[model samples]
Structure formats: structure tokens, C-alpha cells
Target: MKKLITLAAIALFSTASFAQTTWNVDKAHSKLQFTITHLAVSDVDGIFKDFTATIVSSKPDFSDAKVSMTANTASVSTDNDQRDGHLKSPDFFDAAAFPTLTFVSTGITKTSANHYKLNGILTLHGTAKAVVFELWYRGTITNPMSKADDAGFQVTGTIKRSDFGFGSKYGSPMLSDEVVVKANGEFSKAN
Candidate 1:
């Protein structure tokens, strides 16, 4: 009887582990943006036009969700052609040398209902650093058009550009060392 009970418990644990679900970001409804204080007088904003993100979890509340994202460095745009070109050059992102920036969650801690502190490793400009972002799970709903279960989320954080070894020439009043990052996405359940 004890052996049979042990086998049942093991089977239940294995089934729960295999129940992980994956959600893929809907690019049409997502945006990855950043802002930096420029000259201490104005703020400059930009967006990565090419990016992909996913979430994997087994819990209904997504407390155990693991997030991953990758953004194309060359796709950074501030709506100004000259500035965008410069950003892609050796001065800032040096997109040719570092083609992509990626983030993979190491862990997540629930801070409150539908809110979490997401700890992850962010790799930029060939440097990887541990960072934490505030994540808000905006809940899930069935998409009227797609008729699929979709989840919404928003992540916000700040990072020092200097830590990643980028934009060292610009300092203080020229540009702020801190960059504000924000991402919003609608993810559809893949399975």
C-alpha cells in the first residue's frame, strides 16, 4: 500500500511538471520602449521595432512564469533618421558589433496580487548583468477575433548604460546614464 501511494505521488508530480504552458507575444499588440534624459532638459524616447518575447508557466496565476525576450539592436528607432543612424553606429549601441540584446528570467517573486519582481539577466553590448523589473500581470481574456486565451503584461525597469559599457563618451548634462525601459505585450497561449 505504501509503495502504491508513493508511485501515485510521483506520477502526480511528474504530470504537474509536464503541464507547463507557453504563451507567445503578439507583436501587433506589443511594444518595447525606452527613454533617456537628454541634456538634463529634455527626454529622448526610442523603440525596438523588431523583438520577440515568450512566457512559460504551469500556474494559473503565473507566479512561476519564466520570461524571455530578444530585441534587435539595429531596429532601435527614435523617429529621426540621423539620430537613429548614430544610435546604430559605434557611438551608442554599435549594432553591427552587438546585433541583439536579450533577457532571460532567473526567478520571480510575487510582490502582491498580480504584481511580481522579476529577476533576470540582461545581455547588452556583449555584457550580461543581473537586473530586476517590476512586472504587472494585467490578467487574461479570450480574444474576440482570435478566440484564443490571451494574457497581458507590463514590465518596467531602469538600467545604467555605463554598466553595459555603452555610450561612455556622453556623460552628465549631455545624456543621463540611466535608461528607463518599459514593455507591454499581449501573449496568446500557444498550447
Candidate 2:
């Protein structure tokens, strides 16, 4: 009986060790940016200057990966001081009330050898909604600069600002409902 209990404990620990590996975002090599049409005429671009993400997976293909990220709302910038201020106000993001926007994956499905569909819930403006994004795994490499194992991925998606409580209250016609978001980054495997 004692031998059987000891063997069972070893098996459990081994399984847990092989079940999940965590990766940390290499922020210097990552970006969280977006673009939106201005007044149905020109394009306006912005980025979240502060953000972080974690990726955990049990498989080499990352089909079982869990991803989560958070971005500081006040970090949004478009190169125009006045416009940036307006975006930080209650009329837009209400950065003071909702200081951060976050997303946590609910599912990850492999679409091809290197492509995947990431389904998750995004919380913004104090509201949570389902969002699906496309991700392309760019494989892994040993970084020439850091000499560390790094994995790369690209993500693209669109979300309606109005769906998250950004509406006509702030003369919404001046801004489009849909915001195009993109992120390409390398993550380092955590020890």
C-alpha cells in the first residue's frame, strides 16, 4: 500500500510538469496598435503604449494555448495631444474609470499548420463581450541578441467601439464604429 501511494504521487507530479509551460511577452519586440477611419475619409492610427501578455500551452502546436493580456487605457496615443486627451475622457475610453482593457482566451483552434483562431472575451469600457481573432504562428527561434528561446505570432482583428459603450454621445459620427487591431510579437519561454 505504501509503495502504491508513492508511485501515484510521482505520476501526478510528472503529469503536472508536462501539462503546461508559460511564456512571457518580449515587450521590446511587441506592439499593440490599432487603426480607425476618420470621418469616413482618412485613417487615424493609435497604440497602447503599455501592455503585457502571457501564453501557456501543453502542446508544441499551441492548440491548447491559453492567452491573456491587459492594456492600460490611458496609454492610448495618436500623435495629437488634443485628440489623445479627448480619447482619455469620458466621451471615449474614460480612462480614469476603466484604466485597463483585457482579454482572456476561452478557446484556441488550429486552422492550419501555422494558423489558428483564438476565441476570447474582451473587457473594455467596463463591458465584456466575445471576440474572435486570427493568429499566425511564426515558429520559434533562438534570439541572436538575448540568446533565449523566442516564439513569434501575429494577430489581427476588428471590434466595434460602439459595442463597448462608445457611442454617439461624443459625436460618434466623427469616428467609425469599427477599430482594426493588430499585434505581432515574440515571447520568451519562462524558466
Candidate 3:
């Protein structure tokens, strides 16, 4: 009877291990980008050159998942050198003080096949606030060269810049308060 109980315990542990898999962000195939209105007319675009995301899920459908990401604020670039420098200064992100922005998932709800609603807390410029994003799981593929599983995803969200202590000096008429954020990434199953 003791031997039988030990076998059962081993089975349970094995099942749990088989149920979950962790994936590592493929930085070369991922991008984090944002767009904000400029002069209330045109749009200014920027991308964070340095960032990392860790994803773990219990199933292929991703019904239960944990996701988190950290991005370097000083890496923000908007094409023009002067504007990029200003964005990293105190009047804007103050990247020197708050070098990174982070997002941690609080909940993940599967809306349908390939679609999900992701709720999380975004910490930017030393402030943390709840934000919801729409995500699309683009399915997984096996890499031919590496012989590993790779998962792809696309995400879209919008946040009020003012809520994150951004753009107060040139408010509304000159610069819109809303900022649109987007991401497209591929993750490789960690060995």
C-alpha cells in the first residue's frame, strides 16, 4: 500500500509538469511600439529598443497564463534626435530617474479562438495603474532551424498620457492626451 501511494504521488507531479510550459521572448522577432498625436494633427511614432517578456501557460489555448514585461524608457526614439532627447528628459519620461516601465498581468480572459482580453498593471514614470488590452494569439509553430516551438501574439492598447504624468507642459491643443501602444512578438519554448 505504501508503494502504491508513492506511485500515485509521482503520477500527480508528472501531470502537473506536463500541463505547463514556459516560453522565452525572442527579442529579435519582437517589437514594442507606441504612437501619440502631434500638434493635434499628425502622429508621432516611437519604439522601445530594449525590452523583455516572460510568458508561462498551462495550456495551448492560453486560458490560464502569466505574462510580464519590462521596457527601457531611455530607448524610446521618435526619428528626430532632438525630440528623442527631450522625451528622455524630465519634462517627459525622466528616463534617468525611472529607467524602466513594467507591465504585469493581473488576469487573462479568453474571449474566443485566438482572441483574449488582458488586464494588467502598467507602471510608468513611477506610477502604477490598471490597464486593459486586447490580444490575439497568433498560434504556435515549430522552428525549422532550432527545432523548437514558437508562439506568436499581437497586442493593442491605449492609455491616457496625463494619467502617467506625461505631457503636461504642452497639453491638449498642442499634444493629445491619448497614446496608442502596440506589440508583436514571438516566444520560443524554453528548454
lDDT (10s digit) by residue, model 1, range 1-191: 99999999999998987698999999999999999999999999999999999999999899999999999999999999999999999888899999999999999999999999999999999999999999999999999998999999999999999999888889867999999999999999996
Q: Which stretch of 10 consecutive residues in model 1 shows the poorest summed lDDT?
A: 164-173
- After superposition on all C-alphas, the RMSD of every candidate to the true structure, in Å, is 2.5, 3.0, 2.2
lDDT tens digits, residues 36-112, model 3?
Answer: 89888999999999999988898887777788999999999888999999999988889999999999999999899
TM-score, per-candidate, Cα-based: 0.92, 0.89, 0.92
* Better lDDT candidate (1, 2): 1
Tell me the spans in candidate 2 whose CA falls farther than 4 Å from its real position: 1-17, 170-172
Candidate with better lDDT, 1 vs 3 = 1
- How far is 78's C-alpha from truth in model 1 (Å)? 0.4
- Could you tell me the lDDT of residue 110 within candidate 2? 91
> The CA-based lDDT of model 3 is what?
0.91
Pairs of residues clashing in candidate 2: none
Q: What are the clashing pairs of model 1?
A: none
TM-score of 1: 0.92
